[model samples]
Target: LRIRGGAVEAYDGAGGRRHWTHTRAGRRPLAVRPAPGHAFALWSDGLVTDTARTTGRTVHWHRAVPGLSRWLAAGGPGRAAGVLQALDRAARMLAVVTPQRIAAYRTRDGDLRWVLPAEPGCAFDARRTARTGGALLVAQPCGAGASWTAELVAVDDLGRIVPDRTPLRNGPPGDHARARKVVAGDR
Candidate 1:
């Protein structure tokens, strides 16, 4: 499937015959990324479209929505909200991060799963995220001034914080350098 203008088109790979097309009113297409036998599309205004490869049907999830309005209201104007941080196909979760919180949503249906508030004086680095053993690990920089250290947070599949199983600071246990590399966008 491919996104052109405001529509997503599914065409025959062999003969280039158009099979189906879906479009949204008043929205411009931004990107279409491949999922596991599925397609995930994003709009310029933070809207998402989940298109099934087989049926060519689509589900829309506006990232500006649900509880984001509250966050935007509380912060007032000039605060950026509804910014998507990551999409975990394996965990079937979409991580949406704002200045104040990080929220997880079901990728398949756009159901809100959980919301994690940012620690006082610190924010989460969504790019520094990892998935392992049914848990999603996120990194937050601890401390205030010039120097900062990475603090790892482990959230289980059920959206519960796993305190005891949390990995070491600066990265996961046993391989701090590797984790740092990942956080640095080396991999």
Candidate 2:
């Protein structure tokens, strides 16, 4: 609830949950809703979903994707083996900043559609993506405070990278992303 005059008196649930809940400091929220879905949240920090409200389902250990092993091994055999091992999984995207560490999804239907590698200025805290046509926009956050760099990648039919990396600056709605011919498809 807002200040009628000075003091704060929230509505039903909000008033009872003051101790455990907090709001954004300087910014105003446009909307609020409960979290959704049946699959449980896999994060330790807790993730909220709609449809279900407070919590959802737990991501079982078997479903979890393990990190790369032997990725840091020395010699040609190490790196070669590392890449080969990772490619065995059915993935749609193989985003990587380096060969050893990065996160992307592997589709149930083996399709290496896209890869969003971490950019130069990015701190590797958020998702980085390079796409081809269908939902191929990768938004990379700029430094803290304000600004964002996004690239709308274009992929080929074989799901191989076509390079053509595009550079973008801050823009309006829908156009918050931008890209032009840049890098050649390395994959």
> Each prediction's Cα lDDT score?
0.57, 0.28
Weakest ten-residue segment in model 1 by summed lDDT: 177-186
Tell me the tens digit of each residue's lDDT in model 1 across 45-68.
Answer: 555566676567655454554444
Candidate 2 local lDDT, 32-67, one digit each (tens): 221122111111111111112232122211122233
Candidate 2 local distance difference test against the native = 0.28
For model 1, the stretches where C-alpha displacement exceeds 4 angstroms are 1-21, 31-33, 60-63, 66-91, 142-150, 164-187
TM-score of 1: 0.53
> In model 1, what lDDT does residue 63 have?
55
Report the lDDT of model 2 for residue 146.
42
Number of clashing pairs per prediction, in order = 0, 23
RMSD of 2: 16.5
Model 1 vs truth, CA RMSD:
9.9
Measured by lDDT, the strongest candidate is 1
